[model samples]
Target: MDLDALVGRARSLAGGGATRTVLGLAGPPGAGKSTLAQTLTAALGDAAAYVPLDGFHLSNAQLDRLGLRSRKGSEPSFDVRGYEALLRRLVGEPAREAYVPDFDRSLDEPVAARHLVPAGARLLVTEGNYLACDLPGWREARGLMAEVWYVDAAADLRDARLMRRHTGFGRDEAAARAWIDGNDRPNAELVERSRDRCDLVVTSLAG
Candidate 1:
């Protein structure tokens, strides 16, 4: 579907004049989920807010302590319970502003409370790789959302985007490819399995 159609769907879920509504964007890494989430928030203006799940990644120190530095982006490396709690607060306490974390790619770390969802924000767009996951904390997190849209693109395109992302973030070309093949490809496969769980499968947002 196109941008207008996606926006229309989100608007309906927002319920116009009712309580806060959350729209989740789930897809594998490099699937353009963040791009779509940001675009929707820009289109909807103040009525909407974007809160990304990557913001809940565990600290590098924590990863090192847990001996998971080599598998940095794996599900076990994230603060899934913390993410669930944030969603709960957002859904249950609509009258208050909630502070959400944001991941800083440059530092490869999470910056605390960098994103604020104002009480007036009726639509919250949260994008990430694991929103549709059936794991303990992840399943409950998905249940909290009003709806989840799974963004998708050609496999080659996703691979290209991921290669550029890793290289841009500091890895050399060889390392980038290696990481994608060894670490990210497996995660992508797992995310692909969760596509059936999403409310919508967004193939494109070209309109």
Candidate 2:
């Protein structure tokens, strides 16, 4: 939880290589993966760029067609192949500018080109729920990262944060609880199983 120390570590990763290095943060939902990614990117400024896995969420139409609407945030609900391709491009073409996608909680959909990894960015910070997963496309994506960190937090705290997120995004309290119990909890359990695969385990991040 030492802010300055974490910043120094991230800076080292940024400068550690000739090609752009990628630092991945993997954790269950509501474990503050995005918060830590943003903190590092902000501290490093132009030297860092961010790409979030939420951007690869399947559209509602596609979810419905695939009969996965009820399990929207599950692993199979993401376009893992596209995410892997983007990461590959970032690692392979360090000199090129790459547009990144993001998920809009307000619209509950993925938006294209919401972020940019400009040429000369020495580090690319990407965060997601499945970076450490041993599955096919996820495994390929993980192989491209210089390091992967597992962010951890109390389950109760995560549940509270998730409830607020769901309600803030239009779900009623009751519906949010139901969805969390039915969908998010399972996803988190699956994600937690990959914790041992990460290079580091982050218990918390300094604000």
Candidate 3:
């Protein structure tokens, strides 16, 4: 996406007379959804706060109980209802100080109440793999956002990034490839299904 255009839109939504705006960035793993969302929030500074979907990931214990730890990145592994509820709080019934959880990649765990989005905040920037999906709860998310952007990148690029990310987080190359091939890629495909619903389709980053 053109940095100028994206920044312009963010500034307008943040500065305009609108009450509160929730912006969602959805895409496959390694599509730069998180990075773009962070940059956009930074552009808007205090007017924006981030809410990541990863923090809502079901704990390893819960996944183990369901026999789904192996498919940890899949849509079913998330707390869709919790995310929907938070979005509602962020937009429909915003408050003065809203606390949110953050995910620690190194620990593969969620740290609750790590961040706060103050009341009267202008923008709520949320990023995740399944925000725009046609699935039951995800449909509720699409309803919550004032705008959603789907980041699109090449499959090879995505794979490379995924592999690198896995390795960086302590996985061996083979294990990383296996995880990507067995788990993440399928999740990416499933997440991609919701792209058509995005208000904007971003193809590249702006300088």
Candidate 4:
């Protein structure tokens, strides 16, 4: 994958009219969507901003109350309506500065206003596991994007990355494997089904 070419494409997206253009990155867990989105935003500097869907993760308390702790990363575990509203605000109010939330892996919680989309930003780069999902709330979010890119990676590579991520965040190897099999794998499969709905497929950043 040519990083320069990808940057060039992002630059083109940032060169549009006064209305903010949202570029969404959709992929399964550990597919490098966040990495690519951050890279593009960094390269574009003030012209681009990033918003991640992981920010809409329901709190652990909410998950436990709803009996969804074991399925924490699943579609139902997210506040999809909140995510949709954020996207709508970002697209509808380009001239206004907006605060963006983010999920903190260290705290294993969602933090409020960890990022800001400045009024000068012309392009907004958002990435997540379910951006291309065909579900009701997700479909509304996708409709606001100027384009969505499906990030892809090899199964083995994704599994390896997920294992590292889980263990790094306090899960034991056995627990990590079980969670991946029970939760992440199913979510990945569901996201894969929506790949055809994306405007582009991105494998360049998979590595």
**TM of each candidate vs. truth:** 0.95, 0.96, 0.94, 0.96
For model 4, residues 7-120, the per-residue Cα lDDT tens digits are 888778773567888889999998999999999999999999999998999999999999999999899999999999998888889889999999999998999999999999
RMSD, candidate 4, Å: 1.3
What's model 1's lDDT at 115?
86
In every candidate, how many clashes are there?
A: 0, 0, 3, 0
Error of 3 at 48 (Å): 1.0
Query: What TM-score would you give candidate 4 relative to the actual structure?
Result: 0.96
Give the per-residue Cα lDDT of candidate 1 at 93.
79
Using lDDT as the yardstick, the better of models 1 and 4 is 4
RMSD of each: 1.6, 1.4, 1.8, 1.3
lDDT of 1 by residue, 140-171 (tens): 89888999989998888899899989999999
Shift of residue 174 alpha carbon in model 2, Å? 0.5
TM-score of 3: 0.94
Pairs with steric clashes in candidate 4: none
Where does the lowest 10-residue lDDT sum fall in candidate 4? 9-18
Q: Name every residue pair that clashes in candidate 3.
A: 1-204, 3-206, 96-119
Give candidate 4 regions above 4 Å deviation: 15-17, 204-207
Among all windows of 10 consecutive residues in model 1, the one with the lowest summed lDDT is 11-20
Comparison by lDDT, 1 against 3, better one: 1
Instruction: Give the residue spans of candidate 1 off by over 4 A.
Output: 15-18, 204-207
Taken over the whole model, the C-alpha lDDT of each candidate is: 0.88, 0.92, 0.85, 0.91
Q: Lowest summed-lDDT stretch of 10 residues in model 3?
A: 10-19
Give candidate 4's whole-model lDDT. 0.91
